[model samples]
Target: MGYGFAWHPVLLNSLLLLAAALLFNRLAGRRYPHSQPAAPAPTPSERVGVSRADLHAALAERGEVVDISEDDLEDILQRAEERSHQRRFGALRCADFMVSEVLSVSAAASSDKALALLRDHRFDALPVTSSDGRLLGEISLRELLAAAGMHPAPLVGQLMDTCPHTSRPDDPIERLIHPFADRGVAHSMVVDGEGRLLGLVAQGDLIAALFREQLERPA
Candidate 1:
């Protein structure tokens, strides 16, 4: 009358319960699988496809925009495009566009000699360099004219702008744009690490380089 080996039934029931649980878990997983959220769309700043029409439509959708006219907006866009172009071509160094065969007057040269060089070259200014080709200053037509009535014409060193604007050959060409525009800098002497004259960059040169870049840019 003892419970004669009832372990078999208990083991069978345990196995059945485990199987049922596993089957139910598999079914539940099939019915409700894990999912990932969809990615967000690219914003205007992230995508290059945002056009002027898109901007106008966006402004219209907001309703009753004020102050800025369409022309002003177009001008702004043009400026932005120009800035983008600059950034894209920022790798262009001063040495790339500078005129290597520059006509510089020696600092020891007389005022008359400096003026002659400027007039002969049809240049507004000329860089004054030392005998060893180091940049000392710049001489302009105005300086010579200012000393016109002097009993003795001053030397180029005396009349030159000692603190003239200068740029390193490795510098980005874009760095000179502001100086050319704001300070009326006609030429920037491109020097080396030891301040030796390497080349010259005129406003026209910069403008031509940038214009050429624009023309060669892909449509």
Candidate 2:
């Protein structure tokens, strides 16, 4: 006698459900195919403050890896930032950072007095002004030393720098950078149109001001 195979009702229903689920998945995939996730937004340099890690990541993305240490790269970036700030604020005027109410010596003051003032105040140089507040020149430790061996101690007017570099209040601070660097000038007299000393600008003052501006810069 031949036997007939019969499927159980539960088993038959489970097979049908499995086939339907496979079919539905295939059709749904065709209709709404999966896509690569959207590329992440680029990291902004200003927002992240341009760290060495960010630079390395950027270089890796561009396939332009360079053989340099992270410390050296960071130093280079810092110098570039300083130069950028210098160029941006080059137009800043001398008056902006100059020290007002400057301490000055009288032109008629003796060299000894000027030297004493410089030593007492720990100043590198002092402006020499006339009785009427007109800038005559400047006196520095160099001049005072030179005048020391003279037969009669010279007056500040005689020993002072008669043709010192001077800057107008409105002059750009950039105008002084090269001169200060090239000539090793420590200070510049900020004078009015009539050559009356208004204030003084020093290398340190410029540096401090630039640093402050950098710190306060907008992100």
| Model 1 CA lDDT for position 159 | 89
> Compared with the true structure, what per-residue lDDT tens digits does model 2 show for residues 1-219?
223223556668778987787788787774323468795654333344566567778888989668887778866875676466467755578899999989899988888888888899998889999877889988889879777767677889887888888999888776665556556778889999999999999988877876877777778
For TM-score, the strongest prediction is: 1
Candidate 1 per-residue C-alpha lDDT over 1-219 given as tens digits, one digit per residue, 9 for 90 to 100: 346446567767888887787788788775323357686654433255344576789788989866888778755764576566577765667898999998888878889878877778888888888889999998889998787667677888888999888999877777776577655788888899899999999999889888887787778
lDDT of each: 0.78, 0.78
Model 1 TM-score?
0.60
**Compared to the true structure, candidate 2 yields what TM-score?**
0.58
When superposed on Cα atoms, how far off is each prediction in RMSD?
22.9, 23.6
